[model samples]
Target chain A: MSARATTRPGGRSARVQQSVHQAVRDLEAEVGRDALTVPLIAARAGVTPSTVYRRWGDLRELLSDVAVERLRPDTAPADHGGLRADLEAWAAQFAEEMSSTAGRTYIRDALLGDPGQGNAVRCSDYAVEQLKAIGVRAAGRGEAVPDVETLLDVLVAPLMYRILFRPSDLSTVYTDHLVAAALGRGPATPQTKS
Target chain B: MSARATTRPGGRSARVQQSVHQAVRDLEAEVGRDALTVPLIAARAGVTPSTVYRRWGDLRELLSDVAVERLRPDTAPADHGGLRADLEAWAAQFAEEMSSTAGRTYIRDALLGDPGQGNAVRCSDYAVEQLKAIGVRAAGRGEAVPDVETLLDVLVAPLMYRILFRPSDLSTVYTDHLVAAALGRGPATPQTKS
Candidate 1:
């Protein structure tokens, strides 16, 4: 109804903030980032442009927040034991991130063919660093260097490639198989749907 | 200035074609795909947008052509070994493409952060098919399948991820290392620079 909506909640204006954040995600998830604008986000969130600006700064910053949320890992119970547990946990996390509608959208949008190279370059560098950090964390627990790096690469690369390139749906079993293969615990087999 | 630079004899037209093509590439190389426009391309080429439109149709069509040329592999020498050679050859082709300035721009503009999903999906699918075709050919030559694919994936996926994430220098030596590592042909210490 209004040109824009800034719905913050709590006390004076926190309600407006929460409402507007939800609306921004909704607008992007629905029509996509290309279609989203301050005006549109404001309208959906039931707030004004000024309010949206006051809170989120700009569209890029808003999208960055959404992207970050989509990428946050959902940790699993660490009881599987040995590298398998770590591998499974990591692979499942990978699958979860790539398989989500929002995650997929974010990754898809972040690639080379989208809009801005500067943003793409920065985002890609950040992701690489994220992978590197994860690799370092694994190594702290006695994982070797090339071993740790290659292990991470093998466990996650296929899932990533599948998400990017193919229609074939990879499975948790495939993830497990890959981890097993990497750990020299089993053979690497090609996967079909679960 | 004849449009048929690549077609003319004495390699004169070839030079023109190379010059104009390089001009387009340089523009992409300098500012990347986001800042790429017919006006910018024309200015870079020291021509007019009318000339560019006349030569390459529209910007989309021109870019498509540029992408095709920039990425397609020149016929390289074949190996008599087996699937490993085939896979290496194929991966090397891709690595070379991704290493070029134009290729970097294409991937950065096409698949990196904010890469449009549809375009990324289409291109990545086409790339997989291309890899599959190479594998099939390798199989015909008596190369193994499961190992070949795994080896090939190990090589290509990392390269793709690097291209997607690095957005900087790419090199033939780097591809050679990927090929070596994936095939277990030699050590892969990750020769990073250049």
Candidate 2:
């Protein structure tokens, strides 16, 4: 992101940018992602079509800008003083985010390279990187296995897999199980060291 | 799934069915999955257009039947007694199957619901069900955690996500990561923990 990313050519003020952004967002809510056109975005923004095109080359570029703008740092999981709590909170939150209506829609459409935009992969990569960091944190604390990254995925991937591909019901029990598994406690009660 | 699934009304043997399937497979291999079509399939089958329509209704239906027909139950992940060994063998085999030229094209197109076939979702559902059974086996003698299913997703989703979305080197390392995660082993390590 260059400093000039959001700024218009003629020194447009923050106020004007906000107006345009708000209009784009309003159109997104009404028409969903597929129906969003530059003309419509301009009309909603109360600007000329030329202005919209000048600001962004195409719809894909505009969407990409929105993703970059909206990307934020993840809040760290609470210090549960134990790997289980930290991991459980992280897995549940990860599952919830991926399963959200918007998340699923973004992911589903993104998989197809629709509109020639690359936001889906970018966003998912960002999340995966964050999860890796969290795994590293847990490992550093000695509360988790050394290969916490792989362990974390094992503990969390089911929710994401089901969220994107399967029909598994996401429940509180599921969240707990994910937590337990991350802590080296098996998902099911075993007779111990078979 | 019936005997009639093969052969034409005009005394054509099931060999025609196999030939048509082989044609679809060849066309897919040559032109890639994104380019598969009804006419091409018929041409490959060495039959008149009417033959295909009568047998499978539309291109979508034809493709659906082809997909079902190609799915060899014995060819999927094997049952190797233990979760880790089974998953290791399965992941290696499954990855090879999916990453192959034909496998990639088919799964990618299937996900896109190409040919307008409604059975795409069903195919994905069936694979996930198979995955769930694999997960159940991972539980081995343990039964305490209920979200074991989500764990399954976490392990598998990343593999699909990486394969479908990114153009990175699909090395044995990534496969091992996915296989280990799916089996509830620590990250980056082959299924070390039982």
DockQ of each: 0.28, 0.26
Model 2 alpha-carbon miss at residue B174, Å: 5.3
- Cα lDDT tens digits, model 2, A49-142, are 7876776666656665564444433454556665666667666666666666755544544454433325545655555565666666767886
For model 2, state the Cα shift of residue B37 in Å: 8.6
lDDT of 2 by residue, B35-123 (tens): 97777888877888788878777765666567654543333456777666666666666667666665654554455443333454455
| lDDT (tens digit, per residue) of candidate 1 on A27-140 | 866997678888888888788899877876677666654454444433323444344565576667667767666566666544422333444455444444545555566676
DockQ-based CAPRI category assigned to the predicted complex of candidate 2:
acceptable
Give the alpha carbon lDDT tens digit for every residue of B5-114 in model 1.
23345574455456667676778668876687888877776777887777756676566545544444344335546766665666666677666655666554343322
- What DockQ was computed for model 1? 0.28
Badly placed stretches (over 4 Å) of model 2 are: A1-24, A42-82, A114-121, A132-148, A187-194, B1-87, B114-121, B128-155, B165-194
Model 2 chain B, TM?
0.60
